[model samples]
Each structure stands twice: as structure tokens, then as C-alpha cells.
Target: MVVGARLEGIQLSGIRKMFELTTERSVNLGLGEPDFQPAQHIRQALSDAVEKGYNKYGPTSGISNLREALANGARKYRSDITANDIVVTTGSTQALMITAQYLFNPGDDVLLPDPGFVLNVPQVRIAGARPLMYPLKQEHEFIPQVDDLEKLVTPKTVAIYTNSPSNPTGGVMSIEDIRAITQFAEDHDLWIVSDEVYDQIVYDREHQSFLGDYDKVIHINSLSKTYAMTGWRFGFLITKAPIIDKLSILNYYTIACPNVPTQHAALAAMTGPQEHVKQMVNEFKRRRDLIVDRLNRIDGIHCLVPKGAFYAFPKYDFNISALDFAMECARSDLICTHGSAFGDAGEGHIRFSYANSMDNINKGIDIFEEVCEKIKG
Candidate 1:
């Protein structure tokens, strides 16, 4: 039997399989998940929920308490959001899926950065929409050029997906850039899906969010990175009432509801001590400094220090493809993701995640340097 085109064409799992095949006893630095455990208070809250019999199905949009907490959290960063505007989902992934499904009709075009998150493009395609690519330039420090975005917009453009402190590249869009994009989206009546998963991981400047300026902005965020609650599968979408209602309906039919325990856990994550988050950010900063310093010293490797996310996307001077370079690194027992896994524009780079321990980061860089030298020689 022939598989569905959407299912057959998706290559994410293939990338995972490649990592599995090539990775040896080497340190695997490709994963972007936080190395820290969920905070003690959050875990205790989950345990307390279980003890209190909160294991039943939650409200489809998430538990009411969690929604309130998520809304409160959003208000700290952006104005004009409330509990009524929030829909808690399994993760930011589900939020993105629901947004795409609700906003885009078949044949509509969804704009995304060229070296953007791989999942966004396929999700748009699976929603029966065309994924229009907008190139983010290395010369521009990987920030999306508003001019390029303007060129990519079409009459059928329904939404533009942006990741600030972006994955792989770690480029954080400035407030000015965000203002221009929001103005453009407002002019064209397009939805802005801002994935702020790394919002808390920013290093240089305070994070700029589209929600502060546009009511139509759909802000997707999670406790996954900030609170080290990845396996808890907790995330929420912040948008206006009408959009929330639509996503809630789609969310109801899809998963019915997020797990009750996870909702309780997420509530704790929102209300719990924020010092853990600060500490993790500090550690990631240290690791970023270490990695950027080492990678830049390598003969043919040039890396830009990441401003936000815990990733360093570095260009390598070798004839081998990014995929092949990643494979070669794996043979040396050091696992890193090829930039091309994100998209075609990512071809000349490799993404090294600093979400690992300092020891692992140090060792991984040493191994990566050795591999690069061997290839260069």
C-alpha cells in the first residue's frame, strides 16, 4: 500500500535514524533539551496532583487553573492577554499544528524562514498549504530580513511563522524587526505565529514579542525549555478569543485534552520559583562562551556566538555536505545535527547544542576540532 504523501515525504525521523546509526560512545550534543531535571517543586506538584486524584482528563483546552497561570505568565512579557485568550495544548507543536489547520485553507501559502524549524514547513504542507520560504541571511546574523519577507508574501498568504532566539541559529530578532513584521502582517491581515519556546533563554537583550503589538499574534510557548519540563508535554498558545475558540475546537477532536497531571505540573512550573530558570540560563551562557570560543579557533570553522537559544550554528570549510560532516562527526563518536536538516539554506552549517553538561560541551568541542582538522588535512 502506498503511504500518504504527507507521511511519506516527512524526513525528521530519518534524521533521527541517521544520528542513531552514526553515534557511537561519543557525546551526543545534537539534542536541544535542557540537561537539568524539572524543579523539585514542580515534581512535587505533580505528585500532589496524583495524590489528590487529578489524573482524570483535563478540559480540552487544558485545565482552567493552568490556563490562568499561562495567561498570567504571558502578561508579564506581553500586554493584552488573559485566560480567555489562552489554550493549553500538549506542546507548542500541537499549538502550531492547530494554528496552521485553522488559519490556512488548501492552496494557501504560509511564509516561514528558509532555515526555519523543519517541522513548521511539513506541518504547513500536511495542512494542505504551500510553505513559502523566506531566506534568513548569515550576513544579517540569521535574523529574517523584512524585505525578503515582503517579497515572499502573496494574496494567499495566511500566516507567517517566526522563531525568536531561533533554533539552530540562535538569532534573536530585534524589537524594530518585530515591529516592522507586525505592521506588515497587520497590513496584509495575516496571522503571526510567534514560537517563543526559547523566550526565556535569551542572553543579550530582553525578548521582543509580537503579542505586545498585535492582537492577531498567536504566541506559542512551553515549560519545556524554561522549566525543564519537556517530558511533561506542557505548552500553551496565547491569542485573541476567536482564534482560541477555533484552536480549542480542533484541540478537542485531536487529543481531547492534555493530561490532567501535566496541567497541574505546568501550573507549578508557572508559579514556582524562577531562580532555577535563571541558573540554567547562566550555565547555558557559560557553555555558549566555551563552545563559540573553541569552534572559532578551528582552521576552517567559523561560528557566531548565539544570542538566545542554546545552539551554535557554525559554518565549516569542507567540500563534504552538512549531512556528511555530521555523519563523519558521529563516526568519531560526537553527535551534532547538520544544519541542512532544518532546510536547504542550512547546507553549509552544523548545529551544536549546548544543552549538555560543561564537561560534555568541552569534550564534544575537542572531538569536533579533531574531526575538522582531519577533514581539512
Candidate 2:
């Protein structure tokens, strides 16, 4: 059997490729994963759910209790959203895929951020659309400028995909930036897909949502980062009833429903004591500060202080290409993502995730500093 021609232009994520190439002895600083495990209460909830026989297929929209709990939690920030507006999916990745499939037709162009998540471009292509990139310059704290977005929009542009507390860079969009983007979407009648998986992990500022000002925004979130439940494969979307209806059908065809036991655990994560979240955020903040400070102190590597999330995107003074630099690091047993994996504009940088222990982070830096000396221009 022949593969589909649509996949001819797409390639494997460079991040995952690098990850696979690393040996067991490698000190990983690549993937944006939380080092913490799932909270005890959440794990116990899943265990209890399994013992109580909640293993059957659930409603495609989600189990009702979890949906209501999610709605209530979300309403604390976005008051207009209701239980009817949320649909649980396999993960935020799938939530994004559903949004793209629902909104984009073949050849439709969707604006995404440069120096964004590695998966964003491929996901857009899988939906049969062209991906247009808007710059998220380091000088601008990695926030997308409205003027750049406007320049990229054409009649074929159908949507804008945004990630706050962005992956590959821990840059959180400012409230002013959010307002400008929401207004732009309004003026152009374009759908807005907001990836907010890291909403709970912001360091020094409040997490702003496009949902606060517009119903046209589709908000996607998950328990992965916040609760350290990456393997759980649970995520969801918040939108109005009509969109929810369309997503429900799409979800049915795709996942049938999110895993039942995990959904119960996700409900516990949403409605249980939130102090666990605060604790995790605090730990991540500590790691973020430690890593960023260490990186900035290196002679040729300068990292911007990330306002949220747990990554440090540092620009380097090295003359080598990002790919060669990353591979060189790997040879030294220091694993990291090359910035160019995210987009063309990411050529001169590398993304380091502080999701490991403080001890590992410190150890990694010692090796990183040594590698920098070798690669110094």
C-alpha cells in the first residue's frame, strides 16, 4: 500500500528524533515534561475508579460530572462558559487536531507562532492547510506582534493558533497582546485556537485567556503539565455549544471518548484541593529561576527570563547551526532541542526544559557549560 501524498512534505518532529537518538546515559533537557509524578489523590482516584468498574466506554462529549467540574473550574476565569461548552479528549494534542480538522479546509492558511511548539506546523498540515508563521521575536519576549500577524493574513487565512506560556520558549503573552489578538480575530472573522496547557505554571504574572473576551476562541487545556499526568492522555476544549457539537462528532470518530478512569482522575484534579497545583507551580518556578540564571551566566549563552512555564530559550553566540550544536551536545551526553526544530526563525537558539530535578538541572548545566566552551566561536 502506498502512503498518502499529503504526507510527502511532512517530517518527523526533530525534537522526538533527537530524543530517540540519545543513549541511556544521556542527561535529558529536551522534552517539556514535568519531573513530578501525579498527585497522590489523583492517582488514588484513578485506582478507586478502576476498582469500582468504570472501564466501559463513556459518552463522547465526556462523563457529565467531569464536564460540570471542568466548567465550574473554568468559570472562575471565563464566566460565560458553561458545562455544555466543554468536551474531553485524549489530550490537548487531540483537542488541537479536532479544532484544525473542524475549521480548516484544504489550502486554507492558519497563522502559527515561529519558535513555537514542534508539533504545531505538522498538525496544521495534517489538517490539509498551509501554515503561516508570525514572528515571536526574542526581543519582544517571544510574543507575536499584531502588525506581523496582519501582514501574514491573506484571503485564504482561516484561523490563528496561539500558545500561551509557549512551548520551546516559556514566554507568556501579555494581557495587552491577548486583547490585540482577540480583536484582530474579531475583525477578520477568524477562529482562534488557544493552547493553554501551561496556564497553571506561570511564574510572575497572571495567565490571560482569549476566552475572557471572545466566544470565537477555542481554549484547549490538559492535566498533563499541571498535575504531572502526562501519561494519562486526558485533555479538553472549551467553546460554545455549536462548536462543542461539532467537536463531539469529531471526537467520536477519533477517540470515541477519553479514557474513563483517567477522566475520573482528571475530575479529581480539577475539583480536589488545588494546593497540589500551587506546590507544583512553586517547584517549577524554583527550577525555572535556577536554570535561567545558570544559562545567562554562561559566556556565550544568553537566556531570556521566562515569565511562565518551565523552559529557557537561550540565544547563543556560537557560529554553528542549531542542529550541529544540538548534535554536538548529544555527543557530550547533554540532550536538548535545537531551536530550528520549531521553525526557520529559531536557527540560532536552543530550548532547555527545566522539568528535571534541581540536582539534574545543576548537573546538566555543568556539562552544558563544558560543551559551550568546546563550541565557542
What are the per-residue Cα lDDT tens digits for candidate 1 across 272-325? 789989999999999999999989988888898789989999987898999989
Error of 2 at 289 (Å): 1.3
Q: Candidate 1: how large is its RMSD?
A: 1.6
lDDT of candidate 2 over 1-377, digit per residue (tens): 35787777788889998898778888899977888889899999999999999999999989999999989878867887788899999889899889888988898999999988877888889888999999888899899888999889999898898999898788898888899998998889888889999999998778987778677889999889999999999999998626789999999999888899999998888888989889888888888889988999999888998888888889999899999998988998889989999999898999898888899889889998998998874
The ten-residue window of minimal lDDT in model 2 covers: 1-10
Model 1 residue 72 CA deviation in Å: 1.2
Tell me how many clashing residue pairs each candidate has: 1, 0
Model 1 lDDT on a 0 to 1 scale = 0.86
Residue 105 in model 1: lDDT? 82
lDDT of 2 at 200: 90
Whole-model lDDT values for every prediction: 0.86, 0.88
Off by over 4 Å in 1: 1-3, 13-15, 22-24
TM for every model, in the order presented, reads: 0.96, 0.97
